[model samples]
Target chain A: MLPFVFEWQWDIGHGVFMGLFYLALTIVSLGVVAALAMTFYDLYSGKEVHEEGHGHEDPWADYSYAHDKADRGEYA
Target chain B: MDDSKFWPKGTTRCKPVHFGLWMLFCLALAGWALVSAFLCLYKGLNQTNMNDYFAFGVWIVVDLAIIALGAGAFFTGFMNYVLRREELKNIINAAVIIGFICYSGAIMMLGIDIGQPIRGWFGFWHANVHSMLTEVMFCITTYLIVLIVEFVPLILENRQINKVPDLHFFAHNLHTIMIVFAATGTFLSFFHQGSLGGMYGVLYARPFAARGGVLIWPWTFFLFILSAIAAGPSFTTSIVMITEIVTGKKLTTHKVKMLMAKVSGSLLLFYLVLKIADTLYWAFVQTPAMGLSPSVYYQAPYGTWLLIAELGIGGVLPCILLLSPQVRESYWILLLAMLLNCFGVTMNRFVMTIQSLAVPVLPFEKFYAYLPTWQEWGISAGVIAYGFIIFSLAYRYLPVFPQETKLNPTTD
Candidate 1:
C-alpha cells in the first residue's frame, strides 16, 4: 500500500487507492495506540479499576468455553 | 457441560452427535483439499481439465463468486458505520466474519491457481499498470487488510477475551472511530469488484467479453460491481437463514431481514436495467463490428437457452420476486429468490470466464468445452472447506450476531 512499493505508480488510480488505504490504516492504528496509552496511564495512576459491574459477562466467555455445538446449548 | 456457555448463552444447537457428524463432514472435505494440493503441486495444473483456451477455469469462477458474496461485509459496514443504520449493528459482526472467510479463501485459491505460486509476487514486483489483474491484486489485498481491521474489534469484544484491559479499550476506541475504515473498505471493494470484470472486458482478443465504455473501465466493469453488491446482501441473508435452520435459532429480527431484502432487490432492479442495455448494445453493435452475428455467439453446447436462463429465469424472475413486497415477506419466497439471485451471479461469472473462452474468435479456432478433473475439484473443494472452517470458527467463538441474546434468550 505504500507509495514506495515496487508496484506503486504515479497514476491517479494507484495514488487514490493507496492514499485512502494508508489513511484507513493510520486511523485504525491511531485508535489502538490511543486506547493503549490511556489504559497504561490509568493503570499507572492507580485509578480504581473501571470495572463496570460483576454481572457484565465477558463477551468472549462464550467462545473459550465451547468447542462443539451441543455443549454450547447446555444453558439454553 | 454448560451448553449455554457455548451456544451464545441461550441459542439452541443440534445434539452433540449431530454436531460431531457435521464437523466430520467438513474434515472429510478438507482432506479432499489436501489431495488436490498434492496433485496440483506435484503434477502441475495439467491435472486440471483446463487447456490453453480455458486457462482461467473454475478457480476464477469460485474466486469471483466468493468475492461477490463477500461484498455484504463492506456494504453492511458502510450502512452501519457511515449511513448510521443502527439496526444493522445486530448482524454486522456476522457479515464481517463471513467476509473474512470469503476473502481469505479467494486469496488462498488464487495463490495456487497461478502457474507459479512462489512467483505470484511478480504481479506486484513487475507491475503492469494497464493490467486489470494488477488492479485486482492491489485492491483485493488492500481490502483484505481493511476487513481484518474491521474484524479485529469483534474478535476483541468476545466475552472472555475483552477481559484484558488493553484489548477492551482498543476495541472500544476502534468502534468509536470505525467510519474511516468502513469508508476505505467501500472504496477498495468498489474498484476491485469492477476491476475483476474489467479484467475480462479489456480482453479485446475476446469479443464475447469485451465492451466499450467510459475511460478505462468497460460497461462490464460497472455491471460486475452492481451485480456483486446487489447479490451480496442476499447471500449473507441466505447464510444467516441457513444457520438459523441448522441451529433452530433466530439470530436477526424479521425487520432486519426485510430491510436487507429490500436493499438487495432495488439494487438488483437497477443492475438488471443496465445489464439489459449493455447486452442489447453488445448484440446490435459490438458483436457485428467483429463480423459475428449475435446468434453465432451462442451455438450447440452453449445455446440460446443459457441466455434465457441467465436473463429470464435467473435474472428477471428473481428480481421480480424479491422486489415485490408479498414475495419478499414470505420467508420461503424470499429464501428461494435469494438462492436464484446467487445462482444468477454464479452463472454470469461462469459465462464471463468460461463461455468467453469457449466462443472461438478465429474462424479456424474450434469450440472447446472443459470439465474439472478430480484434482481441480479438490482445489475447489479446498477453498470451500477453508471458508467453512473459518466461518464455523468465527460463529462458534465470536458474538457474531448481536441480536442473538434478544432473539433466543438464555433462560438461566
Candidate 2:
C-alpha cells in the first residue's frame, strides 16, 4: 500500500511489504532511466551504434562492458 | 512480396502463404477469446460456472501455471547475466519473448477473470498489504513492466528496425545494462511466485492447501519457488525444441538444450525431494492436526491419481529421464522429460487452486465439483493462441536464437 492511500498504515507489515515493493520498482525504473540517459548521450555525441556482430562472438560481452563503460562515460 | 529481407540473417522462414495461414488460425482463436471476453465483461461473471464456493477457477490455475512457466525468462536472464552461464545467451531472447507473452496473456485473462475489469487497480489503490494476493498483485504487475523493458530491446533489434539510428542506440544501451533489469526481475519473480503459493498455504481453513512453514512464510511458498525455477527452463527449452521440429531447422546447438535440461533436472530433483517431504508431513502431520485425514482430501473426481500424476508420472519420472546422460542426448526423450516437468508444475497449481477449493472445509459442507463453461475455454484458448502468434512473429523476424545462423547455415 502506498503511504498516501487512506487505507495505508505505518505498521511493520506495510513498512516491510511496501518497502521491498518500492525498492524493486525503483531499481527497475532506475535501470530504464540509466539506459535512456546512455542512449541520449550516444545519440548526441555522434557515436555510431553498430549492429551487434553475430555468429559466435561472446554473447555476454555487451553486458560486461555496460557498467565499465558507463563509469568512464565511454559506452560507445 | 518476399519478406526474406526481414528474416534474421542466414535463417529461412516458411513461405508467406503458409505463415499467413498459421496467423489466420491464431487470429481465429483470438477472435473466440475476444468474443468470450466481451460476453464475460458484458454479461458479468455468471457466464462461467464459478460461484461463491469456487471463487477461483480455471483462470487462476492457468494464471499461476503460466507465471510459473514464464519464470524461465527471469531465471534464465539471472543465470546468464548474473551467474554468467553464457550458454543461456543463445536462448535468452526466445525466453524473454515467451515470458512477455505469458505474463501479458495471464494479465489479460485476469482482467476477464476479475469480472469487473475496470476496478482491477483497486487491488493496488485500496491495498491489503498483509494479504499474499496484494503482494502477488504488486510483484506481477511490476515484473511485467520489467519484462516489457527487457523485451523492447529485442523488438528494436529487428533487421529493418535496427537500421534506425536512435532506436539502435537505445536498444544497444538497454542490452548494455540488462543485468540491472535481470536482477530486479529475479527479485520480483521470487516473491510473487512464492506469494502465489503462500496465498493458498495461508488458507488455514482449507486444510488441503494450508501448510506449516518457516517464519512469515509457508512451506508451499518455498516449494512453489523451487518448482517454478525447476520447470521454467524446461518449458523454455521445450518451446525451442517445438520450434525446431516445426521449422525443420536447428535454432540452437544441442549443447544449449542439454544444458537447459540439466539445469531443469537438477532443480526439479531438489524440488521433488522437498515436495515429497512436504507432502508426507502434510498427510501424516498437518492434515491430521486439522482433524481431517489425508484421504478426505482425495475423493472422486479429485482422486489420488492426481497426486500420482503430479508427483510420480510428471515429477519423479521426468527428473529421472532428464538427469540421465543418455536421455538428455536423445532429442525426443529430453523434450518429453521437459514437458512432463512442465506438466508437474501446472498440475501442482491446478490442485492448489481447484482441488483445494473442491474439498469442503466445514463439517457440514459437501465436496463440490466445478466445470468451466465454453466461454472460459475460449478465453484460455485465446491465451494459447496469443502465445503462438507472438512466438511465431518473433522467431520469423528477430534474432531470437543466437546460434540459429551458426547451427543452420544456408548452403546457397
Candidate 3:
C-alpha cells in the first residue's frame, strides 16, 4: 500500500481503491496503537483493577457447579 | 474439568479428553491440507485438476464460498455497531470470529492455489488497476486485517488472559473504538464481495455470465452483493445453531436467531427478485444479441436443473420458509431454511466459477469437464479443519455468547 510501489496508477480507479485500502489499514493500525497506549497508561496510572463481570470475581459462583452437586446425588 | 479455568466465566465446557479428541481429528484434516499445500508449492499447479479451459477450479469455488459466507462479520457489525441494534450484540462476537476464520483461511488457500506463495504479494505491489481480481485481492486482505483488529479484544477477554491488567485494559480500549474498525470492514468487504462477482461479470466474451454494466460495474456485481448479504447472516446463524446443538446449550435466545432469520429472509427475497430478472434478461435479450441461445451454456453436469435448484428450491423456498412466522418460530425449520439459503448462495458461486468456465467461449474450444484432484480436496479440507479448530478454541476460551450465562443459569 506504499506510494513507492511502481505499478501505482495516477488515475481515478487506482486512486479510489488504493485510497480505500490504505485508509482501512491506517484505521486498523491506529486502533491497535491506541489500545496499547491506553492499556499501558491505565497500568501506569493505577486505574481500578476490576475483573470482568461474567464469572471473573468468583468462579465457584457458576450455576454449573450446582449441576455438579446434583450429579453427585446432592439435592439442590 | 482440567480445562475449566480456560472456559468463559459461568460456562461449563466439554471434558478435556473429548475436546482433545476433537482437536486430534481436526489436526488430521489439517495434516492432509499441509501435505497438499507442500506438494502444490514444491511440485506445481499440475498437482491439481486445473487445466487451460478450467483454470478456476474447486479452490476458487471454495474461496468464493467462504468469503461470501464470511460477509456476516461486517454485516453484523454494521447492524450492531453502526445501525445501533442492541440485541445483535449478543451474537456479534461469534459472527466476528467466523468472519476472521473464513477470510484468513481463504487467504491461506489462495496462497496455495496461486502455486507460489511468495509471488502472491504481486497482486498488491503490481496491481492491475482495472481488474476485478486485483480489487478483490486488495479489499479481502485489508478486511482480514480489520477482522483481526476486531477479534483482538475477544482474545484478550479469555478467562485467564483477562487477568493481566494491561491486556484487559487494552481489550477494553479496543471495544470502545470497535465501531471504527467495524465500519472499515463494512466498506472493504462490500467491494471485495462485489468484485468477486464482477470478476465473472466482466467476461464480455463469455455470454453466459457477462452482462451490461453501469460505468465499470456489471449487473452480476450488484446481484453478488445482494446474494452475499442474504446468505452471510444465515450461514452465521447456522454455525451458531450447530454449536448450540452440539454443546446442548442455549448460546443465544430464539429471539436473536429469529431476528437474523427475518433479516436474511428479506434480503433473500430482494436477491431472488433481482436474480430472476437478471436471468430473464440474460436468457432472452443479452444472449440473443450476442447471437447465441441459452442452450449453449447448459450441458450435462451444468444444466438448467442447476438453475432450478439454485433459485426455486434453494432460493425461493428458504425465502418463504424464513419469512413465515410459523415456520421461522420452529427451531429446526428455521435452521433448515437458513441452511438452504446458504446452499443457494454456494450454488450461485459454484455456477459462476465452475459453470461459467465450463461453457466454451470459442467455436473450436470444446466444453471440458474438471474435477478437483485429491490434493485440491485436501487443501479445501484444510480450510474446514482450520475453521473448526480455531472456533473450537475460541468458544472454549473466550466469551463469545453474552446470553449464555443468563439463558442457562446455574443454581447458586
Candidate 4:
C-alpha cells in the first residue's frame, strides 16, 4: 500500500486513497505505541493494575446488547 | 459440578464428539474442493465449463458473490466505528472474521484463475492504472491486510490466550485505538468494492457491462458499492441467525437485529431506486447507442426472467419485507427478509460477473452458458469450508460474544 510500491501512482485516485490509507495506519500505529509504552512503564514501576475495570469501552458495546433486549420484548 | 462443567462455561454447547464429527464432515468437503482445485489447475481452466466466450465463468461469480456478501465486515465496521452505531458492535467481530476468510479465499482463487500464477504479480509490477482490475487487485489485497490486523485482537482475546501478559496487553492496546484500523478498512473497502464493478464496466467490448461515467469509473462502480453496503448487514444477520440455530444460543438482542434490518432496508430502498434508474438508462440510452435492444442482450435461457429474478423476487420482495416496520420487526418475517436480501445481492453479483460474460458482445458472437466443472465447484466449496472452519474455531476459542457470559450465566 506504500506509495513506493511499483503499483503506486501519483494520480488523483491514488493520491486521495493512499493519503487516507496511510493516515489511518499512522494513527493506529501511534495508538499502539502509546499504549505499549504506558503498559511497560507501569509494569516496571510496580504500579498496581488500574483498579477501574473500565477497559477501553468498545464503541459498539451498547449496540451489541440491544439484540438481546429486542428478543426479550424489552424494547417494545 | 463446577461452572466450567457446563461445556462453554457460560452456555451449553454440543458434545465435543459431535462438534468433531461436524468438523470431520467439513474436512471431507474441503478434501473434495482440494481435488477439484488441483484438477482445474492441472488440466487448466479448460476443465471447467468456461470457454473463450465465457472466460470469466462460475469462479468469478462465486468470487464476486463472496466478496459482496463479505462486505458486511467493512460496512458494519464503518457504521460501528466511524458512524458511531453502537448496536453493531455485537456483530462486527463476526463480520471481520468472515471478511478475512472471503478476501483470502478470493485472492487464492485469483492465483488459480490467472493463466500463470507467478506472472500474476506482473499486473502490479507493470502497473496498469488504466485497468480497473488493477485497482481492484491492489485495493482488495491492501484491505485484506487491514482485515487481518482488525481480527488479531479478537484472536488474542481468546479466553485461555488472553492470560498471556504480552498478548493481553497487545490486544488491549490495539483495541483501545481500533478506530484508526476501522477507518482504514472502510476506506480500502469502499474502493475495492467499487473497483470490482469497475472491472466489468471497463470491458468496453461488452456493452451490457460497460457504461458512461466519471473519470475511469463507470456507473456499475457506484452501483456495486451501494448494493454491497445495502445488503451487507442482511448477510451478517443471516449468518448470525444460522449460528444461533446451530449453537442454540441467543447471542444477540432482538433490538440489535432490528436496528441492522432497518438500516439494511433503508439502504436497500435507495439502492433499488438507483439500480432501476441505471437499468432504464442502460436500456434506453446506453444499449441503443451500442446498436442493441435490451431484448437482444437477453436472447433466452439467460433472458429477461433472470432480470425478473434479480429485480423482482430477489430485489423488490426483500426491500418490501425489510422496509415494512411491521414485517421487519417480526422475528420470522425479518429472518426471511434478510435471507431474500442476501439472495438478491448474490444474484446481483452473479448477473454482473457470469451472465455479463455469458452474453456475447461482438456482432458475430453467439450467446453462451457455462457450468462449473466438479473441480471449479471444489475451489468454491473449499472457500465455504474454510469460512465455516475458521468461524467455528473463533467461536469456540475466542470470547467473541462479550455478552455471552452475562446472558447465559452458569448456575451450579
Candidate with the greatest TM-score versus the true structure: 2
Best model per lDDT:
2
DockQ-best of 3 and 4 = 4
Give the CAPRI class of candidate 2.
acceptable
lDDT of each: 0.78, 0.89, 0.87, 0.77
Candidate 4 lDDT (Cα, 0 to 1): 0.77
**What are the TM values for chain B, all candidates?**
0.96, 0.99, 0.99, 0.95
Candidate 1, which segments miss by more than 4 Å at Cα? A1-76, B1-7, B15-17
* lDDT-better candidate, 1 vs 3: 3
Which ten residues in a row are the worst by lDDT in model 2 chain B? B403-412
The superposed Cα distance between candidate 4 and the true structure at residue B237, in angstroms, equals: 1.3
Q: Residue B165 in candidate 3 has what lDDT?
A: 83
**Candidate 1 global CA lDDT score:** 0.78
The alpha-carbon root-mean-square deviation between model 4 and the true structure, to one decimal in Å, is 3.7
Of candidates 4 and 1, the better by lDDT: 1
Classify candidate 1 by CAPRI docking class.
Answer: incorrect
In angstroms, the error of model 3 at B403 is 1.0
Sort all candidates by DockQ, best to worst.
4, 3, 2, 1
Model 3, range B1-412, lDDT digits (tens) per residue?
Answer: 4878888888888899999999999999999999999999999999998988888999999999999999999999999889988778878988999999999999999999888788888778877787899889989989988998888889988988888888788888888888889898998999889999988888887777888878889988999999999999999999999998899887776777888999999999999999999999999998988888999899987889999989988899999999998887788899999999999988898998888889998879877678899999999999999999999999998999887776667674
lDDT of 1 at B381: 88
- Per-prediction DockQ comes to 0.14, 0.24, 0.26, 0.27
